[model samples]
Target chain A: MLSRVLYVDIGKRSSWVVDKHDIFSKYLGGSGVASKLLLEEARPGIDPFSPEAPIIFSPGYLVGVFPCMVKAVAMFKSPLTKNLGESHAGGHFSSALRFAGYGALVVRGASEYPVAVKIKDDKVRVEMADSLWGLSPLDVERSLRESHYEGMQSVISCGKAGERLVCYSNVIVDRYHHFGRLGLGAVFGSKRLKAISILGTGEIPLESPLAVKEMYEKLNHEVVLSGKMSKYHDLGTSANMLELNELGALPTHNFKDSRFKGAEGISGEVMAESLLRRKISCPGCPIACIHLAGLRTDFAPEHEKGKKEVFSEEVLLPYNYEPMYALGSNLLLSEAKNLLRLIYHCEFLGLDAMMVGNILAWTTEAFEEGRITLDDTLIKPEWGSVEAYLQIINNIVDMKSPFYAKLAQGLLETSKRYGGREYAMIAGNNGMAGYITGYGSIVGALVGARHSHLSNSGYSIDQKTMNQPLSHEQISDFLIEQEDWLYALYSLGACYFCRGVYTKEAVCEALKTVGTEKTKEELMKMGKEIFHNLYKFKVREGFELAEQEPPKRVYQVQTPHGMLKAEEVKAIIKLYIKKREGEGLRLKPEEKALKELLR
Target chain B: MKKALRFHIDVLHPERCIGCYSCVYACSRHLFNTIDPSRVAVFVRLNGTIANPFSVIACRFCKSPECAFACPTKALQPLPEGGITLIASRCEGCKTFDCISACAIEALALDRRTKLPIICDRCGDCAKYCPHNIFRYEEMK
Candidate 1:
């Protein structure tokens, strides 16, 4: 009853609910449940855009039951990495699924026409979204909310970039949160799926009310009173911008420089003082880490007004370290308002800010080197110029030229054709994240399941070893240790920002109140199992660790320690592979046979 | 401190609300021993867009509660301590939730499963659990 899975077929326009107790009991929920469902629902070696490819949305067991456990996981074959497509988003989505009495929802088979799947408790309908197909994410959500459902609802939608099949497009959740890293939005587009709206009015049953209340109070007190999460509520993750820049770990101008001279202009402190309009949170989170900036844009174009020549309106856009680095320092657009404008445009187009920023940076350098011409870019790409970047954004979405179309494919493909592979600044075919710390950050991205910095947080380990020399073996050990434990926390669908609060013991205690008893040791073992499960799917799809090499640009930049050596990084990566395979984690013969049988 | 007669919850600072739903969760848990949005007395809503702050809806503890007057069977009664209390036996579980419409602030809502009005009894659980101190349970004379 606690682990019901809703299977929806878009081609058939039908849906059914099944009690997936075996999957939930073994894998738990969130990433674990979603990965298992993807394995069972997908055929090996099929194109990620294939209609039969499965998209699984799952909330962890502790979600909606424990404080700060607000994230939900999405798993599929990534159009970006061509491997495990795993992304986590924090919003009302997880709690919505919880209150709807389902642990996971899987969509299989593509629709011939654009559609929006609407769910109200037990009712599910695939409605025609003809009017909303071409709208932006914000417009799509507004249309669905105003015209379709009433009461509290959570909506996940894609926009024009996804419809164009841009490889790095993202799915926006509840207007602000997102499955931002991978190409889930493109996957939605490939299925002709515009949006999914959920309204959950069902009451969730508690195993023991008193036990839950006690644990909830304890966790809530730790989140609010302990002062651990106060920084997030005050300035959010953008607080890292100034600190990383000071440490020379912030990637600037496409990794040409490690620190930006104008970092203070767009720092979190300045944004909070001048641009911060409001702070919000996901449904159940008390920290309120989401910070929105108010950007006043002049809407009037050649209009005669009574008092002024221009009419302006203020718009709200969320800002954190990723966008701050991607649009601000990394692209050399240091002005806060300018960075916010670019972020708003990406949100409107449903493009991944980080990926687009990486692409733009690479193009700028190529243009400066005379490797690319104006005919290829349509606009002369330049660093620190918002106008040029904005024009490029328009071209990429419209696919104005062959070069622009290639740019929409992503960094790896764009660099391959454009002759800039050395400076592509990517790992595992995905654009490198905000961190450019050292070998740890680079190797972590290369080896990570989703090729994301948050996958292992190796950058933090690099920071810890800045003052002290750490062997490559020590770095590899630390990185794997972080990933294993983080896998467990992520399985609970808790926010990574709250990892400080949800220790292994804390996770164990919380799971018990929900009638699932898990010891710290068991939770850790489960983490390794889930990690292997993800690799199993990735390996089945022909993902190889040796094939994913960090771009040469990563080693060119000067980190806090010094310039990194390629040999040192390669040695660390080799050790990482040995450690991973030494754990006797090869795919079981029965599991492999089952996958083939499912196919 | 002065001894007071009527004690009820009051809004202190609406602007500081984060829309965490902790108060709603606490109220539901306190009343029904479960965390269900349908059974909650306090309602939280985002104001227009993410740019704007959140709004919290709770009983105003009106001296003459409109909810009490609109009930067909007089299931809702105004308590001496302020706010309305529901009489379970008198409640018809009717489809016509006139009490919900009669509330000026729209603080009252119907339980989706039970089809009965969820009236605030001024237990002050919402104020007790509010992390931002948006609510104040005061004794008014």
Candidate 2:
């Protein structure tokens, strides 16, 4: 059993189980599995905060079977993004839940009061959590651990951000890792769920012992030795700062510029030298891409009298490249201590740091341009002002003022309210993170997905176009292939990190272990079918690819690569629409052949 | 020296487990049997959010052996190695869920077709599978 399904309804305080065999088999679990479940349970046009919005958690098939790098996805109608929202968090939780004999957990309705679910093997006990309701994730974790059996239980909790229904609130697992995107935490809070504790001791059987041992040993060796994984292990995602900055793709000051002049201050090299303490791995992951940074802060206060004492203090926690880029260079905060302070505020508030940073950057630009007054704005954020940013972050979590409440709603809503649609740097209502590489596949992916970059990176298309100019038709074909491959990976419930290790042969082999005798070609075809299905779903849900384009700033800014002309970009969009229609109609070669035969 | 040793296995340190399925992989690797996690002697599951942690459940290796007392076929026997072992050959395939209900810990599972009791023999192979030292083997004096 990959996982067991646990269903609970907060409305009636009732719970039951669903086999979910069909879902698990088709999607191979994780986000793919959860997305299907969400679609079924979550009806369109329903308010995300309504009782109808079901929250589902699905663990990957490989979670409790494979070694390391297990991730579980949380899916719901996002209050913030206001679309199909799903977020993945890598930790011991998913693997443990699978081991506990559950594949998925779905919560529906709303609790009358705050409550926590504690599962000890087969027996589940719902405990009152009135005291733990407004506690931060840290405090909640500490309290729950004390009450539960020592060394045997884990707790998941939300902070003040979630309690206040901040649209970017995240569900914090352990102390650091989270389902940090698409406002899953807000969904949990809306359900009045405080935390869930699961404990189980069960075993999974395999058909071939010798084969599994061989595969595990071989895969372990490959992961540790692979160059792709080594880079992640060495500096984690922070390594990208140097690469993206050098490539002139790093978003700076709300993407007003691609390159940050103070890029050196926040490079992975600087982080490793001045802040990094150790690398933290999720579960059995060998790559261990999480770097725990130890930050020191020392700033002298002004005194009218004599001299003020200066002291340094250190704080340690995990930091990743996306958060660093979003909160650091994007906000123009060059000092490591100030950036760390902002990072800490995001964590404590249970907010998606990237979304918050992006929102702040946009607000700063708007403020500078006098598009919005200080009185009209939430906190009057200034570029590179750590003190001001920290105060704003606190205000959002605290829900102190009306403007702060609107700001807490996230960039999409904030921009809409403030008449900044043109300046709003968002894709699919989710703030864009990946640099302006190209419009080939990523644009289509952003437009196609609920909300994510993994739907289609199109980085390859950017690379190809850079080497030599390609026709729009050529770019469309390239994007279609990338999207198909990505769809296949998601369906397999495999992490992108394992893509290198689980090539065509490896995927086939893994499938065989699960009693599926699928050929690589057949699997690829199935992946393509899933991609097409998702594309159709988006269209049905009102996604228009032709309408989705990079913000105007992308074309205006002169990137290191070259200046992108608006007409060239628009032509690419037209080509993409043609290709999408061509694919949708299933008429590329066949249409040409029929016309030729008729003639 | 063939006296049956009375010992218990406690899943004490579950939080340390990353749930890599190392134990599951180890069991299947050694048993040459396909076991669903629902039937495995030991299992781990997520506690809550990704940042929260994991929970573990395994045969507590109860001293009284409620499962053995409840087994009508007398298949669940105390092993000399200090845990309960099942005699799969003697099982009646009755499809009765008595053992499942009798054991307070829910540690017993029945094989799919045979409907025979399946219990942990405490081979310590699970300890070998634990990559993070979440499980361990101990000998009684």
Candidate 3:
């Protein structure tokens, strides 16, 4: 069946539908399909906040029916990185949307005034949202529920941060889950689009009912039997804090050291014991790995005073491993209660918590080194002080102070303005994540994505290749293969949690059900083609991987194993450049052969 | 007495449902021949906000049978045991969403390939799919 694409022009107050059968067949939906749309619609050198910038929401093929890990991809031109930007989030929203029958929604042109779009099973309507324009995501969701009391509907909207056009503003889906990177929310705000509400009742078709039944039974049994799946099912992503801390790979004091002494305070075990309330899963997921943490506000009084009052005196914040490490240990925050408060603030404010933590860490290091005075900056970093962190978060979202305005622009921009590229923890203009696991292959992956760890999670490299380090050339080649594979998974619209289950064979089987006649080998080749295409896009946009360099502090910092040298990291970069060249060469030959044959 | 065909199905209490697809998977275990819940007959949709929770959306087993009344080819028909049923052989692959529009509770869906209407036949298979007891099957009073 051909997937239908819905197009909305908020500026002209127009709505239309297109059945892009060719695009869906080739891209196979989700991010792959959305990227094709983005490349076609978004012009080079156009301001990300302009009407020309497109906001796209595309669901993976398995969304409405697949068990667990149905993520909706929100793609836009990023104001923060000023490059191709996409963020994936899982919630009830995407599945509901898919159930509603459209494969994707492309929103173009700004609304002349603030408005909201409501879609209810073949019925699409746009309503005035001037009253909701400046409302936080939480409020907008509440108002939507009160006004539109249709059968289970999900909403994706922005907060004050997006309305203010904060460079790192994220679009919040279902209040908690977010298209949480690259300022996609700001693009929505620029378009004066307040929210998108979808309630779908249409059903997707299954090819063979008997085959689907057998597949589910076998897959369910495998999931239950797998030890790896067990760990994730128990702790979710929060399982990494203690493990990374033990490896001395935890980013602490803003990357000054690889380990945090207070890691125990916020470890997964600690969170499980103190804060974990219940396990929540997205869409059709059976693992139910997400642990929604219950906050205990009264437990820590010292951390609760002053500017941190916005958080419920008794609150429950979702605790994940990376945010804890980034906003907690990385910022020298020791109290779990306080760390929870900081995380909550970031979510409510619609800021990318990882980038916010990275920028704050840089500011702290600069402050300690006397690069900036207290008068020059608004936030003061005291180890484990949640109140201080809250103050800083407010400043950034509001852009109330000069320091925060620059900080809100993100690490790369801040560093460039303040002369601190040596300490800035960013790659491809995006802030680095919390996984410090391997021989910096993860870092290389981050660089490759124009700065997204998920683009090529190097954690596996750190896990398997830790004992025997690879040469720079080998590392680069390995990363290219990993990156291509990861891109394929993303393109397939498959969740990373099922990376183990969706093996090459599984992927091929899934594709066969979708009517694609390609073998696993052919699918992989297509993935390679997509990877090279992304690289070409980056190059066309003036990214020089050969000249790309990691922050100096990465090399200087001492891990539990030892310190890495600049030359060692440079060799890795050289290897990456060579691999890229090889991929480029293969593409050229394929194109030439096709041309010659045609002639 | 006419022999009543027992079609396995489940009943959902929306208040008890957390919007999770556990039951959806349990139903997919029987229906789609794959783990993909999208193909399953039983699925959950949100009736409200995250704070308000979700509304259970599936076959409601209406007595008046709007879907059967709306079926152009009698593909959807009333069962002797009560509720509606789908006759695969009688279906003519019509894309007409008459049954879908006629469904007040929005339960009926057309199969992707055959374009035949699908209806809940109350066989009580999905009752086991719900771990939280949101779905239950009992002899009508």
Best by TM-score: 1
Candidate that would win on DockQ: 1
TM-score of chain B of each: 0.86, 0.73, 0.78
Q: Give each model's whole-structure lDDT.
A: 0.84, 0.68, 0.70
All candidates' TM-scores?
0.95, 0.78, 0.83
Cα displacement (angstroms), candidate 3, residue A211, comes to 2.1
* Candidate 1 Cα outliers beyond 4 Å, as residue runs: A146-152, A301-310, A587-599, B1-6, B47-53, B93-95
Candidate 2 deviant stretches above 4 angstroms: A1-4, A146-154, A296-315, A441-445, A463-465, A532-537, A581-599, B1-141
Measured against the true two-chain complex, the DockQ scores of the candidates, in the order shown, are: 0.53, 0.15, 0.21
> Alpha-carbon error at A496 in model 1, in Å?
0.4
DockQ for candidate 3: 0.21
TM-score of 2: 0.78
For model 3, residues A209-250, the per-residue Cα lDDT tens digits are: 555555555555555556647777787777788788778788
Writing each residue's lDDT as its tens digit, candidate 1 over A371-487 gives: 889999989988989999999998998899999898888877787787889989788878788888877888899888888999889888888888777798898898888788888
In candidate 2, position B28 carries an lDDT of 44
Considering only chain A, what is the TM-score of each predicted structure? 0.96, 0.89, 0.91
C-alpha positional error of residue A86 in candidate 3 after TM-score superposition, expressed in Å: 1.5
